[model samples]
Target: MSAPADSSALLQTPLNALHLELGARMVPFAGYSMPVQYPEGLMAEHHHTRRSAGLFDVSHMGQLLLSGPDAAAAFESLMPVDVIGLGVNKQRYGLLLNDAGGIIDDLMFVNRGDHIYVVVNGACKHGDLAHIQARIGGRCTITPQFDRALLALQGPLAVSALQRLLPGVENLVFMTGHGFNWNGADLYVTRSGYTGEDGFEISVPAASADAFARALLAQPEVKPIGLGARNSLRLEAGLCLYGNDIDTTTTPVEAALNWAMQKVRRTGGERAGGFPGADVVLAQLDGTRPLMRKRVGLVALERVPVREHVELQSLDGAKIGEVTSGLLGPSADKPVAMGYVSPELAAAGTRVNALVRGKAVPMEVAPMPFVPNRYYRG
Candidate 1:
């Protein structure tokens, strides 16, 4: 996919210099020069994160705060997820959809008392912001928090390392967030991350980000991670990537993200029917149409890395689907991938095949997260 075409200069995160010093291979992503891998390579970095701790620079993402008397009302008009019922300090994954029900982007939305804070994927940030701004009308105030850098500290040792710098950081439970002080600087800490592990994603003031990141890496278990490892880790956990695994052409029903939609957002709710794609989304919710299922998981064969657009076929050579994302999982120690398929063929253990290098390889429709998730529940 092409990066944003705006003539504005690419924005740099506070930790850009640190990444360069660590021998990171920089690449253009979301209009910013970002690291895709380091000297350790993707496999090594991916294993390091699962076994110890890894830090990621996600500053390219867009952060916004919605504040107004009708913030919940305004939000309900853009996405199908329930906002009014969201508890403070809790975070929920949701999608921003266009009027026709096409996905604008997937995002993490946190309810903070009077204001709603959201973090969207970097590649879709501009388009997401523009869509939200145009439809928000005069009911709410949309404020972008561009003066912050987002850092993900993910792994089993994440809490221990973070607690050493910011006491009481371990108090946060899964999917929860809180405002805290680190070295006397204000920080927004959320018990969330892309990797399926116990972790925290902290939003720190731009100026202090570099200093804070340096402090974290000073610990024994903490190490710098890059986008290459990030992708492999998430794929092993069966998580979706914005443009690849999902996009405007897909729906939550097809993407296996129905859990994100709350009961209040159903057709019966007071304001549930006003959001974009309400008709189609509601119909799918009501089961008025056949839902095509797309699952994210691993393949058994160790020979090749599954590439996107590769056709998925039935055992008898009938084409049934296509791959969206694929790679060798450092944690799984094998080739892992995700693809879309017919709903009847989407069940776990269902026999299937994938065409790779002009040859059909035997594969099975397996359950996701090849490895179980280890998020801290308490």
Candidate 2:
């Protein structure tokens, strides 16, 4: 087993040299030296992906292969998601929770016929793997694929660009996956991504990552994208950023992620309350107890942008909540934000105040995906 990352030591992704050569501005993130932005900058990269395809190096995220007949059931013991119900080649969003109903991490799992493939947050992957292995080592094998690198080619033109390299890639629908041979290595291609656009995540050999990314970048519709644009894109799509938006202190329901909780895990289902935090999580789902605060989207009527950790207040000057993630949405061309506030204030059209520099800046609670989602369902 690999030791924990030291405080000052920074790990490098398989595509580190590619990013540097492409003139990406590097920064420390999730204990790795990663690209924060590229030469075209965040704004350009954001808009480019919206209009065309942008290739992203997400190799820092953990990829694991959970094998054995009991893998699904054993995996379910650690999270609130219905792993057994996931069909072959299908994928689902999952919440990893603690015993007290707070989120340990949010992840995505794919059923690969004989085994399950998982992708976890870059920062939480190590701890998440250790947790899973410790809890279910007797039932199944959790093998971390450290030798693989993940790439996300995202945007409206992602399909066309990807199809140029691998024909028939456009045939895949949203949340579906298939294994393909690329560059003489077995690759797993999933028609899913975090940008809320129609895209795909490619899992390839770490040794081939640079060449794979270069091949994608050579396409007319593709360009190299960095982390800065990725953050803004996900924010506009109302997706949560692990530590900033959700942590051990936040529950799935409180984070407006009830959709990620499968029906089987809720009250009155066949297999209810077996996983971690099922008591509190299912109770929240059943509405037996009222929820105090909930995550909601906000749109700035004013042009000024609000940032994370800023206090949110009610019209009466009472602090209701605080911003978890906020930024100027490039696609929406407006300041968009997501934060926690009293449930009563979480609805659309509700007026609220953000304390910016000790002054109350007014905004409205708006429905998310501030821009529409363009996932291909077929």
Candidate 3:
């Protein structure tokens, strides 16, 4: 999460009042007054979501629609992902890149047949909108749906709770979505989320968000989750948080996100090299350019919580890297972190030290998803 801005100037989501009513400890995040945790506390919320369903008010995220015959091709030019090849109703995680191959922001886009729907980070929305408009607005009609409220119903039992409210939602496998009607409100729901769990992200009308959230909370398996648990959950899932783990300075290849780029966008494919920084990204992918550092997962041998910005050093005390995100993963029952390290030291089982208050805390590079991802593919 970004640093707390001026609380007085923070924007309020449609569920703000409901959050207050539920005794949430509000904090300023991404320019919004968001719930950090409710009366049940962060640990409870975290465990609850892991065991059942957790509802998150992600309405702060920017939602947009790009229409016209050129929408797909136009969007494809902004990122390495194969937007043109995306089938209708399919959703894909994407990175918006700059000319130098650094990530501008990470986003999710869905093929809506007539229009391409895009959702961007809350903190980067304004700039993202401007960037897309300036780059592809002439090729496609860009419509920003900032008024929409987005809710993520996530966990092992997420589908059970949501399907009860909106029948047929269970039919949406991971990475797919469809439009639905809920109590006279139109909703576009995708069976996807940041928490690496089988979940659904519902785009509901802002006006009806309160009632919708309350209804979901009424379900025995569903509970309100806050940003605190959301962060830990994503960290445990090995998912990168936009500003924390990725930013304008991080390239997709160096960030270990090569899988997000399809073959069509790689060097030998038909539609390769049209995106911003395509040369740089593709070179890193094909090994024509050497990477200085690589993102890797780390698990502390001790129980100490290693946090972001903590310096990581080699066994011999040579500075090797810095932690980008870390915590005592509630689910993993151990302290885990992700950071960039010298390429030679990025392999799993490589031992390192996280300097906490000048003490060397031993940590070993490990495979990610500190907790195994439970995405429903069937």
RMSD values for the candidates in order, in angstroms, are 2.0, 2.3, 0.9
Give the whole-model CA lDDT for all candidates, comma-separated: 0.85, 0.89, 0.94
Best by TM-score: 3
Model 2 has how many clashing residue pairs? Answer: 0
Q: What is the lDDT of candidate 3?
A: 0.94
Residue 64, candidate 1: C-alpha displacement in angstroms: 0.4
Stretches off by above 4 angstroms in model 1 are 1-9, 296-298
Model 2: per-residue Cα lDDT at residue 28? 78
Return the lDDT, model 3, position 66.
97
How well does candidate 3 match the true structure in TM-score terms? 0.99
lDDT of 3 by residue, 138-212 (tens): 999999999899999999999999988999999999999999999899999999999988899999999889999
Query: How far is 349's C-alpha from truth in model 2 (Å)?
Result: 0.8
Q: Write the per-residue lDDT of candidate 2 for residues 73-124, one digit (tens) a residue.
A: 9998888778998999999999888998898888988999999999998889
Give the TM-score of each candidate. 0.95, 0.97, 0.99
Error of 3 at 324 (Å): 0.2
Model 1, 1-378: lDDT tens per residue? 435544266667789999999999987788787888999888788888998999999999989999998997788778888888889999999889877677889999899998999999888887777888888857899998866899999999999889999989999999999999877789999999999988999999998999999999998999999998998888888899988888888888788887888877875748666778988888887889777666545485646777778899888888889899887667777777899998878887787778888987767777788777999998
lDDT of 2 at 7: 30
